[model samples]
Target: MKLYHHPLSGHSHRVHLFLSLVGVQHELVEVDLVNGSHKKPEFLALNRFGQVPVLADGGTIISDSNAILVYVAKKLKLTDWLPESPAGAAEVQKWLSVAAGQIAYGPAAARLNTVFNASFRADEVIARAHDILAVIEGVLAERTFITGSTPTIADVALYSYVARAPEGNVDLQGYTKVRAWLKRIEALSGFVEFRKTPVGIAD
Candidate 1:
């Protein structure tokens, strides 16, 4: 398998982290986003949206970070990563939705504004970050993982951006539960750390 990605991309990091956790032997193909390589025709052919973190497994191709997580978990028959029960599946999907919506526009977008100079209202994105963190903190106060006791794709989907929220100037200081949750994911076996951007003007 080959993962086309950018190291600093949280979306890319989530997929890479899951593959590592599952001990899936794969190759990393870095997309040169700095030079607009993702916008090129060849790369666009892989994902018409021209995004990083596209997975190529033989003839199968998967895009979107959460989608990639679901695909890999199902393919590996990792029931722990994705539950079979309808209720459990719904719980996991709920957080995955938060990862795509709140997490994306909040922490992820804030990080993009700072780290990549992407135009976004920092205050607004940071506010959204806190709003979602509050909800996550409340849920995590009584559980070990986002969905339940065992880790799931929901945890993976939310990990990278939340872990690096500080880089976006969205402080994680107040959410004790969220901080603890991040540490738990870090301590997991086979866990791979996301590359930290050096503190710069973004700080």
Candidate 2:
């Protein structure tokens, strides 16, 4: 397997962290988003969406971070990650939704604004992010991981971006439950962290 990733991209970070946590060994192929490599013809042909974290699993090419999580987990028979039963499966999908929604809008969007000079209105986005953060804080106060006591794809799905939320000017300072949850995820075995620039996913 080969993973195409950008160091600063939290979406890519989710895939990287999941692979490491589950001890899935793969060759890392860095995609230099900074240099417009993802937008090039070759990459565009591989993934019409031109997104980071395009995973090549033998002859199969999978794009999108959450999609990669499902594919890899299912391929490896990681039933715990994707689950098999109805409630357990729905629980997994629930937090994946959070990954694409609140977590994306909060930490991911904020990271873009700070690091990429992204066109979003900063204050508004941050406030909306904080509102979501408050809900997460309340939810986390009652549980260790997002889905339940043990870590699942839900935890792995949202960990990277939210773990690095401060970079986006979203405060983790006031959310004690969130802070505790961060520590919980980090304490897990084989948890590789997200990297930034000139490393991890280099050109």
Candidate 3:
């Protein structure tokens, strides 16, 4: 399997964390987002949206971080990664939803905007981002991991973006429980670190 990704992408980090946890071996092919290499034909064939975190399993191609998580979890027969039974699977999907939906628009994108000065729908996007964080805090308070007693793809999906929130000037200071959960995820065996996106002037 080959995983196409950027080292600094939170979305990519989520997949990396899962691969490590599951003891899955794969090659990493860096996607040069800065140069827009993801838009080229070779990458577009793997992901029509030209996104990082694309995976090639045998001849199969998978995109979107959450979708990749599901595909990997299912392929590995790691029920803990995605669980079985209708309710358990839906609960897993809920965290994946938070990862792809809220994390993308909120903390992750906010960090890109406020730190890197990327063009975004600033006020509208960030307001909604903060709203998402508020809900996430509530979820964090009830559990060590996002969706369950044990860490799963949900936790992997959420951890990186929230862990690096302050870099975007999105203060995580008030989310004590969430912050604790972050530390817990970091302490796991075989856990690799997620780097703070390079610090820079807010443009």
Candidate 4:
């Protein structure tokens, strides 16, 4: 398998982290987002959306961070990371939705503004980050992982951006449970660190 990605992208990191956590050996093909490599014709052929983190497994092409997660988990039969039952799948999908929705526009957007200078209102996005963080903190207070005791793709989906929310000036300090959750994820075997950048600056 080969993962085409930009190091600074949380979306890319999502797939990268998962592969590492699962002990899957793969090549890393860095896409130069700064030079608009992802939008070029060759890259577009891999993913019409021109997004980083396109995964190529033999003849198969997988796009979208969460979709790649599901594909890899299912392909490898890593049912522990992604359960097979309907109720279990629904529970994991619920947080994946949050990862794509609230987490995307909230903490992710806020960090995009700071790290990449993407044009999003700082105050609005930061507030949105805290709002979701509050909810996550509350949910985490009731259990070990997002769905239950075992870590799932739902936890992976929510990990990268939320762990780095501080870069967006969305403080994680107040959310003790959330902070503890981050520590738990970090402590997992084969866990990989999401590359960090100073707030309001590129590295």
Error of 2 at 99 (Å): 1.1
Q: TM-score for each prediction?
A: 0.97, 0.94, 0.91, 0.97
Model 4 Cα RMSD, 1 decimal: 1.9
154-203, model 4: which lDDT tens digit per residue? 99999999988888888887889898889999999889899999674321
> Deviation in angstroms for 177 in model 4?
0.7
* Ten-residue region with minimum lDDT total, candidate 3: 194-203
- Writing each residue's lDDT as its tens digit, candidate 3 over 135-170 gives 878887787787868988888889888888776667
The residue-level lDDT of candidate 2 at 87 comes to 96
lDDT tens per residue, model 1, 61-133: 9999999999999999998999989998899899999999999999999899889999999889999999999
Residue 141 local lDDT, model 1: 94
Off by over 4 Å in 2: 196-203
Candidate 2, residues 90-171, lDDT tens digits: the string is 9889889988988787767877887787977878778877888898899998888887888888888888877777777777
Candidate 2, number of clashes: 0
Segments in model 1 whose C-alpha atoms lie over 4 Å from true places = 200-203
With a 3 Å backbone cut-off (N, CA, C), the pairs that clash in candidate 4 are none
Whole-model lDDT, candidate 4? 0.93
